[model samples]
Target: MGDCTAQCLHRRAPTEGGAIVEDFTIIHDEGILEVLWRPGIGIGPGELDVLANTITHFPRWHASPVLVHLNLVRHITPPARKMLVAYHHAGPIGLTGSDPVDRVLAAFIAQSRSRTRYFTESAEARAWLSLIGVTAGRPVPAPAR
Candidate 1:
C-alpha cells in the first residue's frame, strides 16, 4: 500500500496592543503605577521610548522609587528586556505573567525575591503592595508640615 499520512496545522492568536496610547504612571506618594499594555500587545524596541515618552504626557512618570503594576504580559522578547529597563525607577518591578519566560528572565525574576514582590493575579499584586504600606489607584495626601 502507498504511504498515507495526515498533516495538521496550527494558528497563533494576534497580539493585543496597537498605535493607541499605553497607560502607565508612577505616582510618588500614591505608590502605585498603573500600566496599560496597549499600542501593541507585546513589547518591542520602540515601545520603550514610546512609554518613557509618555512621561511628557504626565508628570507623575518621572517619580523615583516607583512600583509599577504590570498586567497581562503574555510574551516578552529581547527587545522587551531593553524597554523594561527604561523603568529604572525600581527593580523587582511588579508584573503580571501568564506566559513563561526564558532562563535568564526567570533568573532575574528570582532576584526580585529580595527587592520586589510578585503575584500571578493583579488583585493579589495590589494587595501585596498595600500590605507593605504601598497604595495603588488611590490619591496621595499632601505632605505634612
Candidate 2:
C-alpha cells in the first residue's frame, strides 16, 4: 500500500440548515461522491442514519461513484457493515486508508461488490476509479524530493 497524502483528497465542510456539522463531510467532485471519514469514529446504525440523511438531502448524488477514505474511522459495527453491504449503491467504489483492518474490510466488501478497490494512497485509488469509468478529482502531485 502506497502512503500518498495528496491534496486532491479534502474533507468537505458539513453543513445542516446553517451550522457546521463535524461528524463527516460528503463531497461531490469530478463525478464521484467522496466520503471523507474523520478518524476515531465508529460507524454504527446512527452513523448510517446520518449517511442516509445526507444522501437523501443530496438526491443528485444517488448512483455516483464513492471514494471512501476510512483513515479516520475506528471501526465499522457489524450492523453498520451489513447495512453498508445492503444499501451501498452498485457503482464504482474506491477505499483508501491507513488501518490494516480497513483494508481487510474493504477486501471483504469487494468480494461481493464489484468495482471496489483498496489503496493506501488516495491518488492511486482515484486513478483506479478513473479506469473504471468514474471521473475522479485531479490528484495533487507529490512534492519535489
Colliding pairs, model 2: 39-72
For all candidates in order, the CA lDDT equals 0.43, 0.67
Model 2 C-alpha lDDT per residue in residues 41-126, reported as the tens digit of each score: 77788887877677554445555677888888888888877776766465678888777888877865676544677889988887
Compose the digit string of candidate 1's lDDT tens values, residues 1-145. Answer: 0121322111122335534332333333344444545322455555556556554444444432233334444445676664454434532345554434433343444443234554567677566655444433346677999
User: What C-alpha RMSD separates each model from the true structure?
Assistant: 14.2, 9.5
Against the hidden reference, what TM-scores do the models get? 0.48, 0.69
Worst 10 residues of 1 by lDDT: 1-10
Best by lDDT: 2
Off by over 4 Å in 1: 1-31, 64-71, 83-87, 90-92, 99-115, 131-145
Specify the highest-TM-score model's number. Answer: 2
